[model samples]
Target: MSVIVLDKLTKDFKNGRGVFDVSISVKRGECYGFLGPNGAGKSTTMRHLMGFYQPQSGSATIDGLNCWRDQKQLQSKIGYLPGEIAFPVDMTGKNYIRMIAKMRGMKDLSYEKELEDFFEINPASELRRMSKGMKQKVGIILAFMHKPELLLLDEPSSGLDPLMQSKFIELMERFKKAGTTILLSSHMFEEVERTCDRIGIIKNGRMIQEINATELRHSRLKTFELECEEEADLNKLLVQFPKMLYDRQTRIVRISVPDSRINELIAALSVCRLRYLKEEKHTLEEYFMQFYGGKSNV
Candidate 1:
């Protein structure tokens, strides 16, 4: 059975800004990446999934149960890490974790202690005095301590350093290997590409694209950048490759073509003397640009 499902889920706010008709599905042991710019309804959709907000229309389900109606049951089965956290202003991290554990009816905290050690979080300090990174670590440890079957992480790596981000990815990989289903939302392409099986791109509160991670990695489309020995060489190449991006002053031409047309591109470049010819590294950034609007970038 699909572990997570959103069927035409719609939530409209009073200001006419909200998610509309968004649908997605995630299977057991699969990691689904949810990506969108800031205020593009990413957080709104997550909130609905977590049963924090009731959907005005449509539905969200996890393990064949309604997210809103069966939230109590769902909460135990899933662990959620929100984009922003609200910690008690005066409570120390040690006390706060203890309080949560007590509320959760946890008698044995061996695993939770392991999480604290794993993340290098110092639970002795007060929450207000903790750095952003330390707080984020605390959040991550709390989310994973329960060892839930499904994870709903919204910008899980926010405020984390690059080394810690890499650790987060490794932790996720371990979870994946253990047959955990995850729905991770983030704007970081590298992190998403590294951990997710499929990526769903949202724009203006609607889904704009769904791409397979492996297919993206081995895509037929490739971009190349070339610097000609002379301006004439560049001009000659431009005539043959009309679709190319070129700068006359710099004598540089950039073009994207399918792998099958590499011979054609090579043929066109052969007639021109090239100063430097190299294939540009293609990242998910360019792939995401088509769906990313300028109004809000998150």
Candidate 2:
């Protein structure tokens, strides 16, 4: 079952910027990641999905409900965390959550204790005085406590520490097991690699690629460092593998080849009197750069 669908969705802002002809879908009980660099229209797409802005063309639907026409009904089933946080200065974390609960007409604060125990957040702290990480924890708890069917998280772990980030990942896993559909939008590739089943990469307001995490990992290039007793004429071998990248300096050679061609590369390199040889798989950052046309810096 597809919980969310974007059919050629296009949005243009007054300044002539926004996503263009985007089409993607998130299946029920699946976690999909929306990834892009800063200023790449990720937030614009999310805003349209949340009904903050209407599309210039095409359509977006959530659970068969038109996002723009059924805002109220759709919102009730979705939990959202914006990229930025701005809470009332006078309210404590507890009061803020209570207010949201009252507005949603949901009672039963039983989950409050569970959230506090897992996140180690003190609800008594004033919103203004809490640390950024603490504030983020509060937002996460609020989003999950209601048990909404769909979650829209924008850079959800921006302010969290490593420990809390791990815990949040665990929480997402639990939510997935419970059959919740999640759309995670973030610049953090590692988080997406860990939590999402599939990822869509947006570049300059256009989606460039959509691939599964497992497939991406398997398709990544493998890096190898080779040192020979004497300068080796590896050009002939390199030409055999079109995907391989090689650099040689002072009897030291560095080679990178797609994972699928590693066996051929290994057989070719075996003939040389190698002083040193090491092979390593590329990380998610490397895969993103290769697929999305960017520098390999995560």
Candidate 3:
């Protein structure tokens, strides 16, 4: 069953840009990755799902409860980590977590020890003195301490060190094993590729594609470099595969073809005295680029 569902969800701001007719579903016990570049409506979509902002049209729901209408009840079943960590700097890390626990009506402090041991968070450190990474660890602890059924994480690892990031992934795996649903929103392609079961790519407030990670890897475009015995017939080849990009003067050719055509290309190349034939499979970055015109540094 779907843990979360967005049906034609549309949210418009005064400036007139937000998620446009966005529709998607996340299944139970699956890590759903929502990916896009900056200003690509990622955060807006998340806000709609979390009931922070009501959509102008359409609807969003969690566990069949209307997100905007049943927000209070939904909050009890889900934990959220926003992209930015805003806290009372005067409070110590331990105090902040305890306050959150109290707000959620959870009395047990047992989870605190486990979280501190795993994240290495210093309970006594003041929020003002903690590094950005350390503050992020506190946010993670608060989100997971209650053991909610669903986790809504928006760039949950934005500030952590490499070691801590690795630990965060391990923690996510543990959550999945325990039948928790996770919705991870981020621009980091590598992190999404590692942790997500299925990913949805959005561009200009519209969802361009949604595919399983394994299927995307299998169907990724492969780039091949072919050097023919003599000057190759670039014109003929270009017509056959219009997507091919070539440089004839250097006798170097680059082309990205679907997996289905790989065997055919190899068979045709076998006839020529091939100097080098390399396959370049698309990474999550490249797959993201396909929808966003091209990759952006941001």
Candidate 4:
């Protein structure tokens, strides 16, 4: 069943930048990857789901509860990590975690301690003196200590190092295994590809594509990079494969052929004098760049 739903959700800013007609549904035990660069309304849509922003039109709901109107009551049911974090400078991380836990009426520090150890964090450190990565770890602990039914994470691994990022991914894997629902909004492609079951690519305040991660992982499509011994060979391939991407400087043509057509491609390339033929692995990052005109500002 769908635990999270957005119906034609829209939020307009005065500067003419905001999400328009945005809609997405995240099911129970499913991790939904929300992808977009900065200023693409990814954070805006997340805020609506968290009931931090009221929509100009449409609606957002979590488990049939109105996100905006039922936010106070729904707070306990969801864990959220905002893109930017702010902490009280005077308080130690331990104090802050305890205070938030007390508000939730949680008396147990067992899980909290486990989390601190797993992330290698010293929550007793002064909040103001902590590094950016340390602060991020604290935010992570705050969000997951309670183990809510749903998690809404915006750039959860933002300040983490490579080691910490891997740890975070492992943590998410455990969460998924335990049937936790998650909405992960991030610009990082590899993390999303690894953790999410499905993905929605949003750009310029609009969703351009939605795809199943499994399909991408097992796609029959393959990219071939072939360098020609002579420029004529490159011309022949380009003329034969109009869909091919050619580079005159490198004297190579890039062709995407399905597994079924590999033989046909091989036959066609045999007639031309070839320097080298190589199969290139198609990455989620490369697929995303296609929508962004093969370039990205972010």
Q: What is the C-alpha lDDT of each candidate?
A: 0.87, 0.83, 0.83, 0.89
lDDT of 1: 0.87
RMSD after Cα superposition, model 1: 4.6
Measure candidate 4: CA RMSD: 5.3
Residues 15-61 of candidate 3 have per-residue lDDT tens digits of 65788899999999999999876777888888887898888899999
Q: Over 4 Å off in model 1, which ranges?
A: 220-280, 295-298
Task: Tell me, by lDDT, which candidate is best.
Answer: 4
> Cα RMSDs of all predictions?
4.6, 4.9, 5.6, 5.3
lDDT of 1 by residue, 1-298 (tens): 6999999999988575899999999999999999987887888988988999999999999989999999988888788899999999999988988887787778888988988877887788999999999999888877887888999999999999999999999899999999999999998888887889999988878887888987887775788998887988877776777889988888888988987788998888888888888998778877787677675323
Q: Candidate 4, 256: how far from true, in Å?
A: 8.6
* TM-score of decoy 1: 0.79
- The residue pairs found clashing in candidate 4 are none
Each candidate structure's TM-score, on Cα atoms with residue i matched to residue i, is: 0.79, 0.78, 0.77, 0.80
Model 2 lDDT-worst window of ten = 289-298
Task: Rate residue 168 of model 1 by lDDT.
Answer: 90
Which window of 10 residues has the lowest lDDT sum in candidate 1?
289-298
As for candidate 1, its clashing pairs are 38-298
Error of 2 at 41 (Å): 1.0
Score residue 13 of candidate 2 by CA lDDT.
65
lDDT of 2 by residue, 1-298 (tens): 8999998889876464788999999999999999887777888888878988788998989989999989988888898988887789999999999999888888887786698889998789799999999999989988888899999999999989989988888898889899999999976677887888999988778788888877777776678887766554455555665554555565666677777777887888877787788876456876666645565322
